[model samples]
Target: MNYQLNINWPDFIKNYWQKRPLLIKQGFTNFIDPISANDLAGLAMEDEVDSRLVSFQNGSWNVTHGPFDSYDQLAKTGWSLLVQAVNHWHYPSTALIAPFRVLSDWRIDDLMVSYSVPAGGVGPHIDQYDVFIIQGLGRRHWRVGEKIALKQHCPHPDLLQVEPFAAIIDKQLEPGDILYIPPGFPHEGYSIETSLNYSVGFRSPTSRELFSSFADYLIANDLGNYHYSDPDIATRDNPAMILPTELTEIQHIMQQLLAQPHIFNHWFGTFISQSRHELDIAPPEPSYTVEQVIQLLCQGNTLYKLNGLRTLNVADQYFVNGEQLISPKLNITAINILCEKQEIHADMLGNALNDKDFMQLVTKLINDGYWYFND
Candidate 1:
């Protein structure tokens, strides 16, 4: 996955990312598809895969759980199958997500593949995350509009669609063409033929959502339990009214939670490394003893890399799989390579393995199916 970085990455991100939409023709010259339509359908059939089929008929929306055996039963039009978290399950699709890694991994989400029949689309809807919609096979007509009054919109139970907007850019995208739509943009696509679209979405959590998730994490982890307290406070004269002192105490608790650098980093890192849902991991059929696992690593017969996992290293800590590995002795250079780069050479694991605890940690990861070895 070699990218020329043709567009100035930083400037484009600062100026247009999440602000507007753009189409880059020939985004990847001579690009080969990582997964075929059949392969995608096969994945959808898996019980653990997050898949859905959405269709519209008689001016009403209908959606069903997928693992669809065939598409023949449908109206043949006005329907789409969406499969989320393709990257976690398919190694081939990783290339589709490579370009977006230039931005922070936390900002980038997963690759969602949608297969649409002729004239199929979800509708004119806005997304909360930035997305790159890549046309794979056939062609699709895309129309995008600046965010405007959504009141004119008529809602369907399954889809959040608006009345058609004056398209700022209306174009038919062929294979290899890309449509990049930022958050808040209203866009719709219609397939001229049976089409496959890969939506590479970036993460954009709202403040409210983040706060809620963080609060949940705090409670789950049994951290930051200080309650609002005002020993010298007086009750409000108005029976129904809350006291200003209580508000101040609540604000103080929030400030205190945010002020602790260690706690904040730990929580944030765990939240980031944690998978949105349990990934489909095929653990070793016959588990090995800890000594056997260590021997495999020592023998250089097996290679281990994190599975469906991304890690962040801030300060002296490295975070992965919702846990922090605080290692001042571990080489920052080595750790960075492990986090960002998918493949790591056998020699790189040498120093880390010298420590028995570290080797055990690696073994546990492999045993838990968070890491896999190449034998």
Candidate 2:
């Protein structure tokens, strides 16, 4: 399903995005659920899927991690089962993410689907990332509080929650309604009845995380090799005291490493292009040769990019799943089509199919489980 989002992008970006909370009623008009609750539960049973069960009962909060074998012991009410990165494994669920492409793809995280029984909730909590929660199938009452400093505690070792806050926007959300909450906002939702909710979250990396990753990259690539040298030795008042001039020089040396655009950009492109979740990759049992792929395309076969595969372009360079493709012979148009579109065909490739280097690259990607023929 191709889901259509109804919201003003410019106005929302200016007034609401990361600034406040909003309840966009009928954000997806007549929105049909892309994946069923049964399917979500099934995904939770998979070893690679990240999932959890959260319940509130007996005046206490409880949390359980999955690959759950059975739901037989679960409470009829006051429990919710959540599966993260459903988009990676479920093809239909990826449609839920396509509409949000108005935002940058790198910043978009994954689709988390939760099925809740009556009175089910995880308690009031504050998140550091922005999220859009879309109500599906059944009704759920949601409450969002203003973004303010709040004390946090955990009833369960795995669960972190915030103190209850005064509700600023409180309402029952029906199917297709969306609640957009930015970072630092305290929010809670409980199922009025059996319900399903799809949350599309965005990634917001902290400076510490970025620096840590960059530092690791620098070390791995043998960068920042320059050593500090003070040729002009002026005797200080105390030999133990490091001069301010020496400190400034040391900082400049560190800054110079980041100033190299080529190295920095390549590292960032490779780093950010990686998916945070495990992908459902099934490479062909018998991989097709370059000539075989060309013949298939020529025979009107369509190629679809693997769902949740990250293919990104950084300054004319293309990176897929954290690996850069070396293709000096490939044209920008071909690269753009490969990076931008989910569906690729002979018409889209055009004369690029005739390019030997480009054909070999495509064949490599296809065999590596990044892309596959629709057949």
Candidate 3:
């Protein structure tokens, strides 16, 4: 599933990104689905997977959460099965995301795969995040409208749909075609035939989200607790009224926490690098011994990073699964590979293999299910 997109990255970002919707015909030439409909269904049944079954009957839209026991009761048409973060569970689908790394790894949310029957759709809706929808399997009629102020209503408790807007881009997308929709745009897709569509969604964390995350960080680290001490006791007319100077001083205490770029960078690096959805992590039944893992790596075996495992670096720090790995043992080359690639084979060892401490760090990762090595 090596994917290549036919578009100019800089121009697309400058002109169309978050500005308007663009329909790229044959975005991936002669595209093939990385995972089949049947395979997607099986993944949906797994308890750890987040999935949904959306069906429209007569005039009502019904939303059902999964792990569903059966889809047999669902109507033959007007139904779609959507599995979120499919890349976390499906290996082939993970490679489909390579081309989109241009959108910063931390901002990319996940690959959501939907299998739809004829006349199936989730209804016209607006999202807060940008998305690139790649048509797979069969044809789907997609209509995208510009970002506008529209009234919205909740047809189903789980779904908030917008009133239809005049479409700016409407067309029947064949396999390999892609429809890029920016955030806040009203858009809808109607299945013309049985189809599987892969959506690569980007994450735009709101101020609320960052505030919540940073607040938790402060509490966890016991920071910014400098007491409000009035060093110069001023004779105030009313003791109850806190002076403007005192309030400004209090604000600076909190502001000082963010002023040090290193502290915030470390906190953010760990925060954004964590997967929001349930990860498909399975440590070996009988975990491999350190020697066993090291031997495999030395023998030219690959250590495959788990899908959805967030490995990243900030400055000289390396982080995996939300915990920064800080050690004198950690070197630049090894950290770079872990942060950049999904798979690390023996040939990539370079000088890291010569360091015992580096090998041990990788072994610990394998045991934690962040990575695995084929025997």
Most lDDT-accurate candidate: 2
TM-score of each: 0.88, 0.97, 0.96
The parts of candidate 3 lying over 4 Å away from their true place are 233-243
RMSD vs true structure, all candidates: 2.8, 1.2, 1.5
Alpha-carbon deviation at 170 in model 2, angstroms: 0.5
Candidate 2: deviation at residue 77, Å? 0.5
Q: What overall lDDT goes with each candidate model? A: 0.76, 0.91, 0.88
Candidate 1: segments with Cα more than 4 A from true spot: 1-6, 152-155, 234-246, 288-307, 326-331, 348-357
What order do you get sorting by TM-score, best first?
2, 3, 1
- Report the lDDT tens digits of candidate 3 across residue range 1-375: 688888889999999898988999999998989999999999999999999999999999999998977778877799899999999999999988889999788889899999999999999999999999999999999998878899999999999999989998989999999899999999999899999999999989999999899989989988767787887978978879988888898888888888888789888988988998989888887877778876787888888999988887776678887898766667778778877899898778777777778777777778888898755
**Candidate 2 lDDT by residue in tens digits, 1-375:** 989899999999999999999999999999899998899999999999999999998898899999999999988899999999999999888899998978978889899999999999898999999999999989999999998899999999999999989999999999999999999999999999999999999988898988998999999989888878989967978889988898899899988878898988898888888999999888997998999999999999989888888888887678999999887576778888988788898999999989999989999999999989977
What TM-score does prediction 3 earn?
Answer: 0.96
Sort every candidate by lDDT, greatest first.
2, 3, 1
Model 3 residue 193 CA deviation in Å: 0.9
Better of 1 and 2 by lDDT: 2
User: Backbone clash tally for model 1?
Assistant: 0
Candidate closest to the true structure, highest TM-score: 2
lDDT of 1 by residue, 82-106 (tens): 8998888887687787777888777
**lDDT comparison, 2 vs 3, better candidate:** 2
